[model samples]
Target: MNAKTRRLVAASLVAVTATAVLAGCGSADRGGSGAQGGVLKLWTHNAGNAAEYDVVEKVVNDFNASQTTYKVEIEAFPQGAYNDAVVASSSSKKLPCILDVDGPNVPNWAWGGYLAPLELKGGEVPLDDQLPSTVGKYRDEVYAFGFYDVALTMFARKSVLDEHGIRVPTPDRPWTRAEFSAALADLKAGGKFEYPLEMGTGGSGEWWPYAYSPQLQSFGGDLVDRSSYKTAEGALNGPTARDWAKWFRSLVTDGYMAQKSGSSPNDDFLNGKSAIEWDGSWDAAKNVEKLGDDLLILPPVDFGQGPKIGGASWQWAMSSNCAQPEGARAFLEFTRKTAYFLEFAKATGTIPATDAAAAKIPGYEPGGRYEPLVRAARDFAVVRPVTPAYPYIASVFEKTAKDIVAGADPDAALDEAVKQIDANLKLNDFYAD
Candidate 1:
């Protein structure tokens, strides 16, 4: 079989497995008893993340203590294996009533009938108060919500920028494309670091789309046409997209960034190996600890369409097969309290979803050290494409981006990627409305 055929076959196998899994799980009446009576199983992707797991455990314990009607039992899975475990359990009709889903996958799982629409009454955490990207919606209905979300930013040291005469950018006055490139050149000229910028290219999987796609969008191109969600024909391979590809490749070719950066880009930044690091808000606390007052969380540069950053983090949702959705919803609602949001943000070093929650957190409050992150999320965040075909889109983009950065012809690689993406969307009937 040809390469396309192999990819098709692999995609087909995954679809068939997903279908079987959904069918098996859907056939049962798994939603447990009502809100007042029985155990509600909750699964989370925090098995190895001790700090996050502790917060989840505390929430479950608090919920059980607060209610006589339901007891929530918890199961944790490692982030890498969580999705597969959920799929396998779903195939066997053994999925938990409540589970945590990565924000981007919420649309896919909900479309596949793996999740139920969330039911929230008026004045429950004020959905309006939460960051726009934290609420996972599909087809105009919310399927999940998260207490915290992460923001992407360019990390640098104020002292380095000041010493080098590089202007520090902020949310209101972000660096223009020319200025950003000039800064990189200036940093490189100093000969103080191995690379002027660490793009975190060593990270794999979702990190590719999450980290780099925003740069494409900022250049006035997108993964797919949002108006129809039908194809990536013009969007993925358009002129602006080509510019993004070329510029991205130039970073490595010009030696401004490493083609394959070290394992921990943040560590490298702290260790003075790189002048700037493009990373997530989760690294803010550590960067601050090491750099003290010198740490600078600068806004992303504006290539053209203003600055843009990836949004949405892990969120909670009810399983379609859950017999006790109300019970599960109760637990979710309880966990959305401001105190819990503050607790999770403190524990995970993530941005709280709500303003009220942000106020309670030390560095996240208004005018605090990490407050720029909240502004970044509010002003520049862009959630990944909300389509059932997103997984395929992300995978294709990841491979094509890596190829482009490795010196593949920009137009040719993107064109081929567009072709593959179009084919996948068509095969799936455009993931029809």
Candidate 2:
């Protein structure tokens, strides 16, 4: 799509405006004794996930109706502008009582003392049944919570597979890179598709970490060490990294995948231009609507080692400066417990966080058309490193991958990334013995 078209599409997808309340939220200041006695602000950007806003509206309305101590005002913000607004709000102490924070933003907000630590309140739902990797931690503290979990998996048009007599890949037995390359070649030879795969472009490391990392991990590579911030000591610069870089460069160099124009791969797949699109399960709902019921998904390509891990945690955190930490905790508790979140996930195509919720969720099956795509969240989930300096480390990984794909030397890119990461660690006083 052209730049103008892309922007238009993006704007359409993310047009969310949060309604704010100025007065009658109670006269309690943030830290005043009236902590539990004011208007609470809640913000989120998952409008595309589901259309059941009324379900949540009822839940919040119920909470408001049931309480006299505080009133919660819920608002929706455009996903593109959400983070900036959060940052700006942090500066003026205008931070909401509850906010939807991305995994990467967890550490920054936590360490910067912009958010309050969460404390489970009365009537809080048990999250022990949730995926440990999904609702677990941010810098060793549980800040945000997610109801829907997403993973990167392969997507194919059933018509294309049938036309080429190609077997769809499965989770237990996924296609090898060689097999994938052959399938793409066959499809193109028959004039079925212009490119074999639709790769993601630069962003908040969403699609790249999900769709692209699998190829690298198939070859035993990784973007960054989830356990440690150091790239030199871990998996980012090893043989796997080099092999992965070569594989990616081959797509552009060998004329399989098209040149990266910074377009969304999901759109390409939906429009029938690309046969295979590497993206997260988060796009499943829209794809199903656009591409039809014949959509077949494959697990991450198995590179002989094992399936690569791909998925990110969406967390909810309390502001450390929150005037009513107790009230904030209550809000988080309500979000997780009510039927609101489960219904919300069903609409969005996100994997449910809790196993019980996952099981109780209507229409969840073992191995069907949409199963591989949804179950990918369970089979190949990998949490990004939970550290104060992770944003810097994540940047290093993204830049190195991009540079190597653009023809820069793999070893050189890794080395530079390592230097930057190490410097960030030291600069942040995160140096270890």
Model 2 steric clash total: 13
Q: Lowest summed-lDDT stretch of 10 residues in model 1?
A: 27-36
| Candidate number of the best TM-score | 1
lDDT by residue for model 1 (1-433), tens: 3333433332332243443233333322243323325888788889899999999999899889997888887777667666765665554446788899999988777776677898876435777789999999999999998889999999999989998899999898999999999999999889897689999999898999999999999999999988888889889999999999999999998989989987878888999998889999989998899889999999999999999999999999998778777777778877777888888888888999999989888888899999999999988999999987788889899999999999999999999998998898787667653
In order of appearance, the predictions have TM-scores of 0.92, 0.81
lDDT (0 to 1) per candidate: 0.84, 0.64
lDDT of 2 by residue, 1-433 (tens): 3333322222222222222322312222243222444767666654443464455566678788876777777666556556555554554465667767776556556665556557575544576656655563645666666666777777888888988998887777788778888887787787766677777654445545545666666687665565555544446677877777777787877767765644566777887878887777777767777777788767887776777666555566665556666776766676776365577667666777765666666545554445665566776766665565555555567667778778888778877877777776655456221
User: How many steric overlaps does candidate 1 have?
Assistant: 6
| Best prediction by lDDT | 1
Clashing pairs in 1: 30-323, 31-322, 31-323, 31-324, 32-323, 32-324
